[model samples]
Target: MLHLRVIAPAELRNPILNVLQREPGVTHIVLHPNAAVEPAGDEITADIAREAANDVVERLKSLDVQNLGAITLEVLDTVLSSAAYHAEDAADGDAADAVVWDELVARTRDESQLNVTFLLFLCIACLLAAVGVLTDSPVTVVGAMVVGPEFGPLAALAVALVRRRMSLARRASAALLIGFPVAMAVTAGATLGFEALGWVELTSTRELHGVDFIFQVGPFSFVVALLAGAAGMLSLVSAKSAALVGVFISVTTVPAAGFAVVAATMGDWDIAAQSVAQLAVNLVGITIAGVLVLAVYRRLQTAKESGGRRSAGV
Candidate 1:
């Protein structure tokens, strides 16, 4: 279930209240007249079934409620009311399968920004992965993967494409296009520093057995990327953070970028090229899978809503 808090202008209060009252998936409605100070309107709150959230939010948005006043939606972790149960039962589909697109857009928009925090995390993850590459430690590589923030922009790009949000697409694109190169450049400098410090010789033909997979681009690499991408998108839609962490650890994007920069800095052109290829494959696979998954979810949602309307003879 979701909790909706709305500040409605005086002129639209009745309409908004009526919309909520008429919806079978809404309950616990409260109206506080003249409660809003800044917006100077009524404060209305309601608990709504997750399955009906998109429809309810869309109707509210169509009334320009968000522009005129404000609308806030929050997930309800626990709703013990019998009315809440009835509301959920009245909805057309399972709550877990519902996709609240407005929420998603808001989330991805925030995550996709090319801010300092994003760059810092990416650079740190790449540097850690570089360390992993030098030591041939899969554990360190996995840790680096878990630390990488690249997935947000990638997922944001996928969402933007599916939703046709051009501005979002551009932001996400800028994050990836700029973030990776910047992170690689930083890690490459760190690699050179390590070489100077006699930490590890990058020029030697030392075979990295455990971490060599970071550069071995093959069918399995693409396949793993596709699976990870699908899982990542699923985790996002479902709000499963644990699953998202697993998705993070399942791909080699960060490690490949790290290794590519290190190899290039050391003048290992052949290994650098292979690492670059692996990075490209992973990025492409994850993006393709994410786009497909989101598209299918949108299609399924439309079909479900349409079927519900038909069943109600609307």
Candidate 2:
């Protein structure tokens, strides 16, 4: 369930109420007239079923509540009311399967920010992967995979493509296009710095067994990336954060980038090239799979809403 709060000007309050009252998935409606001092509008609040949240939010947006006033949706961790239960029961679908698109777009938009912290995380993750590559440590490589922040932009890119939001698409694209190269360059510099300091030594013919797979590209690499992408998006939409850890572990994007830089530093151009290929394969696979998943979900949602409207003679 979701707790929805709205502030609307006097003139539009009635229409907003009409919309909420008409929704069977809403309950515990409370109207505090002229309750907003700064905005000088009525404050309306209600409990809404998660399955019906998107439709209600869109309706409210059409009334210009977001600009003229405000609309806030928060997930309800605990709802003990019978009315809330009834509202959930009245909704069209299961809460677990619900996709609140506004929430998704907002989340991915924030996650795709190109800021100092993002760069730091990326550089650190790549460095860890590089260390893992040098020492042939699978555990370190897995840790690096979990630390990488690339998935956020990748997921945002997929969402932007499906929603046709060019602004968002460009932002997400910039993050990935700029972030990866910058991280790789930093990793190479760091590796060189370490060698200069006599902290570590890397040779072209070094026998690396445990972490060699990071540079080996094959059909299964793409397949695993595809699966990880789908799972990542699902976890985002379904609020299954635990599942995301597995998604992160399954993809070799960060590991490949790390290995590429380390291999190049060692003058192993052949291995570096292979690592680059692996990185490309994983990124493309995840993106393609994410786009397909969101596209299919959007289609199904449109069909379901259209059917509902037709049945209601709307």
Instruction: Highest TM-score: give the candidate number.
Output: 1
160-209: candidate 2 lDDT, tens digit per residue: 99989888889888888889899999999998998899988878525988
What is the model-wide C-alpha lDDT for candidate 2?
A: 0.91
Reference-based TM-score of each model: 0.98, 0.97
Q: Candidate 2, after superposition: displacement of residue 121 in Å? A: 0.8
Candidate 2 Cα errors over 4 Å, as ranges: none
Distance from true location, Cα of 277 in model 2, Å: 1.6
- lDDT for model 1, please: 0.92
In angstroms, the error of model 2 at 35 is 1.8
Residue 211 accuracy (lDDT) in model 2: 87
- TM-score (C-alpha, index-matched) for candidate 1: 0.98
**Lowest-scoring 10 consecutive residues by lDDT in candidate 1?**
200-209
